[model samples]
Target chain A: MNWTIFHQQVFPIRHKLYRFALRITGSIHEAEDVVQEVLEKVWKTPADQSATIRNWEAWCMTLTRNRSLDKTRDRAQRRTAPIGQEAEYQTDGADPARQIEVQDLTGQVRRFMEDLPEKQRMVMHLRDIEELSYEEIAQVLDISLDQVKVNLHRARKAIRMQLQRVFAAEPVQTRNS
Target chain B: MKEQANIQALLDRYWEGETTLDEERQLKAFFSAGNIPEAYQAFAPYFQALQAEHAVQLPGNRQAVRMHRPLRWFRLAAAAVIAILLTAGVFWWTGGPAQQEQQALAPVMPPKIETPQPALTPSLEPAANPVAESQVPKKQTRKGTLRKTRSVAPEPAPEDTYEDPEAALAEIKAALALVSSKINRSKHTLEKGLQEVNHVDILHKKKKETDG
Candidate 1:
């Protein structure tokens, strides 16, 4: 397909993809990188001779999730693969708020999401943020529906636990953040 | 299947991921009341967020966005493979030995030229074989005589005509001397004057001498 069409189609979906990537990667910079990389691939590629993007957002989400997961896994491991595993966009340009609109609670939510188990984090993103069907989540995550439901419940439970702890630690006046 | 009073047990199971489809249906219905049950009150925000996500517009770019976006690289590789195959097909079409053979078998057309005069000039040239000319009526019967000479006696033309030079010269001198002796002295003086020489003059001279 012509790049103009691909670019125009991809541009409108950038925010959604960025938000999804951020939720998955837990870093605004990484989210932007994933989205830009996906767009670059779509822009420079031809559909006839190559793979066609069936659902651009889902496609971008999968790429973003994998890269983010890879980075997270790499960081968790002492033997880190350089910070550039599947890195695409620059963190320098554009504002950093693209990750989480600068609200402290939002930042906390993002951090807590990162702190959660990877499976749980991914489940929460697919179920809550993306509002995917259990089957769809299962398909994306390569898990059973039961696993999806379990992971989603655990993810929500973790979020609630973090929020409850934050509320208990801080004074009521400032706890909402 | 449980009525309103016992619904919280199913909701708890659902929070714990132990709820079945039947119980989840009850939750959707119970939440539809627009009023909160005290037991389910804390879960309200969570369900509400779910509703919002369900209705959320992601600005779907169907043309560009894909279900499995990252596998695009593999797809690209597949596309490259397809292109390479097509090129191979083209090579097979144009470069096959069969195609070369077809070219070899193609008809060769001679060049066209115009020469109208040559087409009309065949009758003007004599027959190539001199012997063959005798077949035509106007050709001299001498051809038959020559053929008879070749077949009956292998002799040269000079042998038949005047092979003995001395005998031919003697005969010619004797005839000329007789003519000279017969010539009148006064006529010789007149003959010395030149006359118009048509080919018929030779015949006329012979006839005049006979008459004289």
Candidate 2:
């Protein structure tokens, strides 16, 4: 394992790989394990294989996805999606009540995303949260670009529908108040 | 108002998965802004969740996965050490012991024959009769003088006659045997010559008695 390549190329993108793994395996610990496994694998790659790899980020994301899926399949148990820590969210200029309301809605949106189908959830996570290109998402997921677009569309539409219901309820609650 | 419409349009494209990464960023910015209109406020949480997801980091010590670089020179050094050891082993196996054995056997070599005696050369002079010098008592006196002379002179440094100690021993034995045979032959010649001299002396004394 060459530490130079791993530290320079793989270390900087560790969070990116972790996020992708978390989206797939749906557990923080499992996701961390998957990222660690991917980084070690990248570190141990022979010089010839490393030379052939053009994009370290994409390769690591792909490895994370595969390792996470493998770990998920091995356990064969229901996995929970990771919820962003409340502390991690920027609540910088908001009133306390507004912060609580935004945090509640954020949890609701996270659940909506969690309810999505596997392909749709992965595509949405990669595209919106991780901000990967359609092509890059396809490369990581080993799916067609068209499939990435289709899954992303369905995933967003589902979340939007769920949001609409919440928004519709908000107006009613406000009118009643 | 135009900016709001454009953001609304970008948001629509974002849901359709038609927005580029830059356009999505714009949408995320607009939704995250504090002054969003009441209608768009419902979607603010979603953009906030995405930002929060982006902000998520891998927890725990980063140093856990790091490894130290291996000591590469150790391999070369090990190989060189093995090579040197093998070469030394081969030398010892092939020839080292015999040379050692030779050195060890050197101190126990049989004493050298004092064959190059300078005094012995004068005994071979033709001007002297062999019968006159063949007396046993006179020969013992000459040997005593030679031994004294040998003790006074510094001995020459010895050189290795041959690598094989056994062969050098055999050659020295053969030379000693040859020297003894030559000495025996000379002793017989001197006895014969001395008998003829005694016969001549006897005949001369009888003729002198007759003449008297």
Specify the highest-DockQ model's number: 2
Residue-level lDDT tens digits of model 2 in A1-177: 344556687788887887777767767778778877887788778766777788888888888878988887876764444455444444333467755665565567767987899889889999998888988999989999999989999999999998888776774111101
TM-score of each model's chain B: 0.26, 0.33
Q: Tell me the tens digit of each residue's lDDT in model 1 across B96-198.
A: 6765554443322111111222233345334574554444324323433333323321122322446589987986798678555544432343233222222
Cα displacement (angstroms), candidate 2, residue B170, comes to 66
- Listed in order, the DockQ scores are 0.04, 0.17
Q: Tell me the spans in candidate 2 whose CA falls farther than 4 Å from its real position.
A: A77-105, A171-177, B69-212
| Model 2: docking quality category | incorrect
Off by over 4 Å in 1: A2-9, A49-53, A73-108, A160-177, B1-14, B18-212
Give the worst 10-residue stretch by lDDT in candidate 1 chain B.
Answer: B107-116
lDDT, model 1, position B176 = 70
- As for candidate 1, its clashing pairs are A49-B79, A55-B65, A55-B66, A55-B67, A56-B65, A56-B66, A59-B66, A59-B69
> What is the lDDT, from 0 to 100, of the residue A24 in candidate 2?
74
Across residues B81-190, which tens digit of lDDT does each residue of candidate 2 receive?
Answer: 55655566555433477655654454333332233332345466434666654663366456645544343212322343366989979978987796677656655655
